[model samples]
Target: MMSGLSRSCAVGLLAAATLLTATACGSGTADTSAAPGGGKPEVVAAFYPLQWLTEQVGGSDAQVTVLTAPGVEPHDLELGIPQVTEIKSAALTVYVKGVQPAVDDAVDPAKSFDAATAVTTIPAGEHAGEEHAAGEEEHAHEVSYDPHIWLDPSRLATVATKLGERLAAADPAHAQGYRDRAARTAAALGALDQEFAQGLSACRTKTLVTAHEAFGYLADRYRLKQVGITLDPETEPSPTRLSEVAKLARAEGVTTIFTESLVSPKVAEVLASQVGAKTAVLDPLESKPSGDYVSAMRDNLKTLQTALGCTA
Candidate 1:
């Protein structure tokens, strides 16, 4: 019943309202907004370890949002639109390069902090000739360096210090707070590193057999040899590889085969039965543990000590 001109005007008004709504929401650019009235910088942590580290370094000065949820495997985390937008809007995104391909793709370089950059990285373990399951080839580690830097308390201490500086640079008003927290976090990690050094100093066996190659940093830090069943938990080890590892395990007197929470225990169980060794849970910490980082790591230390037959 309306005239053409009226209809045109109505369409124009609707378009204008839509545009205004979008403007109110936001754009692709970073948000950089302080949290409510607290003026805390918004930080995005890619996973559990980074989340804990960020919380320690940022303290009251930062509001951290963790991308990976507890008990979820972080290696194949798929980002939703909201998560991508969150990465864009956050003042800083803390992640280790090559851990999650989706996170690596989503983060803006200028607003992101790669934790691996803070420490000297070790070479990734070789998994040549290892056969993968269907649709699991994409999960293979593509980076030259292993991305599990958080396993080493000493290296993680370095990351905490650097993260504090980065946060200080981002939120200058809270620079002192950030620095203080960083120092405290670094000190805590340093103490943990000392504990590990002392506890692992007199182990009867130094061979650490794991389900996945997620503990290279830990092995490097403690001077232990890690024998991984596969490069990735999703990757199925070839029979040849399994037989080779089992032979090595028998020769080296490896009493325990380690499995993680995220990965299935069947592979480890089979390998253990083959080598006449027992299977134990050795958390890689790719996901959040029941306790906080420190507690979980302490638990890990205990597990390692027992498995290795450490005197201290």
Candidate 2:
């Protein structure tokens, strides 16, 4: 899939780079079209990750509708009335606050399971915000967090707990089921976190270069330094910036440049070739994944282990 970031890099490549909206990348592919049970209420997710969470926690008690289509970049998403209707009519709507500006405009903040409410985020402009000042200092080191919270399993587990409660409230008949599912999902996420800690514990290098900045949470969680080729999905970095990255890539001995399943690999390919490094697919879980959340994440774990040369 051609991700918004890759597209930006292709055309914009440091010249008047544009910023990609948070939804620019579609996430994991899960079976979201499952038939609802009798009285199984409707739950509308803003994107793939939310859809996956609701699907897992809600199980058979809810019918999840993900607004983002496969292969479609969610960034700069201009939603129509039909999609708005889906959100307005659903028994519950869950989304990240800053992920899709369109969703924020259409959905009521008080009623939705907003992930931004639960997780600390990087400064708005760090990734999705459009008002970031353009200058040489924009790339300076900072402690701001990115909004891709689900990349960190512990944060996602927190979201699952809160979303499960919301589901229970919406579907009283299956309240216990919702709670149980949340507990199980949290346990699984916890185990995944443990695996990552153990797996990445002995990596030869703690640096990761990705096509976009979606891995902030993941890198932070796993103690890896992330160098993104395109942090702003809509715009490409400046030539000066690219040159700096290329130089840093050489200095860091960064051997891999990762593209994603949802985004275009062209930018990574170009950059990898420039750096004399190999390209790999490091999914950020941005699309309607071909597999469920756990499987998708496990695949990511294996890829990370291999790419980072983890001992475990």
Top-TM-score candidate index: 1
Off by over 4 Å in 1: 1-37, 132-141
**CA lDDT, candidate 1, residue 129:** 51
lDDT (Cα, tens digit) per residue for candidate 1, span 1-312: 999999999999999999876654444343344343245567899999999999999887788889999989998799999899878877899999888999998999999999999999998876645463432456554578989999999999999999999999888878899999999999999999999999999998999999988999999999999988887877888898899899999999999999998889999999999999998898888888999899999999999999899999
Error of 2 at 144 (Å): 7.5
Cα lDDT computed for each candidate against the true fold: 0.87, 0.74
Using lDDT, give the best candidate's number.
1
Model 2 per-residue lDDT tens digits across residues 163-183: 899888877778999999999
Per-model clash counts, in order, read: 0, 24
Error of 2 at 56 (Å): 1.0
Give per-residue lDDT, candidate 1, residue 7.
100
